[model samples]
Target: MSKALRRTFVAATSLLALLAGASPALPTQGTFLAPIAEHHHDSSLMYGTSSNWSGYAATGGKFTSVSAEWVQPTVTCTKTDTWSAFWIGLDGDGSRTVEQIGTEADCSGGTPVYGSWYEMYPAYPAYFNNAVHPGDHFTASVTTTGNGVFNLTLRNVTRNWSRSIAKSLKSATLASAEVIAEAPSSSTGVLPLADFGTVGFTNAKVNGKSLGASNPSVIDMATKDGVTKATTSGITDGTAFSVTWKHS
Candidate 1:
């Protein structure tokens, strides 16, 4: 994370992005919107090759549940606007639907902002009124409660706050499970990524099995041409991993 290396990574990522016909990065602000597409443009940073995803994913199983724990990162708004989200979700690897819930840390007007929300793909995500801030401990889970019905839950261990929502998606394929730190999408495209320093996830599991037991893919945020967007640490002790900010 040195100044020279960071600058190199950013320049290379930006060049590759321009070559890929991507739009120039926008100045992101306000609350995250429910994505209009089933997949976000930032899926390039994901690790798996199952169509769409940039996070660790387990395929070939009827993934019943996925969970992970992370302490909020201290985000800094060195620039005017940027965005990032941390969440656990099911589907969206080989399916059109994604069931997800987590928190967002956004840099708006050079100020760090935080909040929590949930999304059932193809529908708009809803933000919860519960407070979220840097250093809060969070545990989030997405469960497939049979027949494409899902139960999503998120808890703030430091605040004794939690929220759960149950919804049904009859067409869900249950193809994959994911734990992700993302540059969330909006109507325009992928938003400018926030500088979240580094965030670590522990006790990551799918269907009650650790990530190693599930044999999921390890993902680093990069484009097809090999320019780094973010760097992900290899899975350690089956359950822990980290994603460090590289470039927006």
Candidate 2:
């Protein structure tokens, strides 16, 4: 094979090896350099508003699982840098810890980029070295063993690729289960929201039950000053809903 073709073959082999747990984690790249943790705008809520998150969360339980499906939304990028992530996880509502995995659509130097990642909060996310694009169908889940062990899985059905990782986080409180579309954060604070139009999430489940049956709290993303950024629709069919971006 030519050098370029050989390099392509090597990368494809490496990604397969990594996804199958045959290879160790690689260095971070693309727009996934920093930790992406939940940054709440309203700490307490009847139905809350967050600076970074817009989705449904089931609280007041020992939430052992959360799973959802979404099509990666295409981002409309400008010269401005922005970030958005869709994920399902446990904790980070009333607890300090979060075990999450999902995909991101971002803007860098006026171009749109897509990627997948999993993170045990307080640590940086480990990205999956596979191509992701707008309109790729994805299903992701984060589940715990009721002890400290977790299983984080993401599958891109459109591309026929999947990754599942086993992890442990003793500090996780199992306080809440959530499926969220968020403007991911940096050390400074919540980053700008990407113009992702709208993303529909389906088959939302918590602990094997439909999320709508869990009395999930609906969250809308807004600024500290009360400027709305994204709006979440009511759950339908006991399993589906959508989040629409409203502002940066």
The C-alpha local distance difference test score for the whole of candidate 1 amounts to 0.69
TM-score of each prediction? 0.80, 0.85
- Each model's C-alpha lDDT? 0.69, 0.77
The numbered model that scores best in TM-score is 2
User: What's the true lDDT of residue 179 in model 1?
Assistant: 84
Model 1: per-residue Cα lDDT over 1-248, one tens digit each? 12111111111010001111111222223444442223322322323321112357666678889999999898888756787878888876556677888887778788777777787776667777677779999999998766878999999999999999999988787777888777765544556678899999999999998977886766556644555566677788989998888777
**What does candidate 2 score on TM?**
0.85
The local lDDT score (0 to 100) that residue 28 gets in candidate 1 is 27
Worst lDDT run of 10 residues, candidate 2, spans: 6-15
Off by over 4 Å in 1: 1-29, 35-54, 223-226
Question: Model 1 — which ten-residue stretch has the worst lDDT?
Answer: 7-16
Report the Cα lDDT for candidate 2.
0.77
Off by over 4 Å in 2: 1-29, 33-35, 39-44
Distance from true position, residue 75, model 2, in Å? Answer: 0.3
Residue 85 alpha-carbon offset, candidate 1, angstroms: 0.5
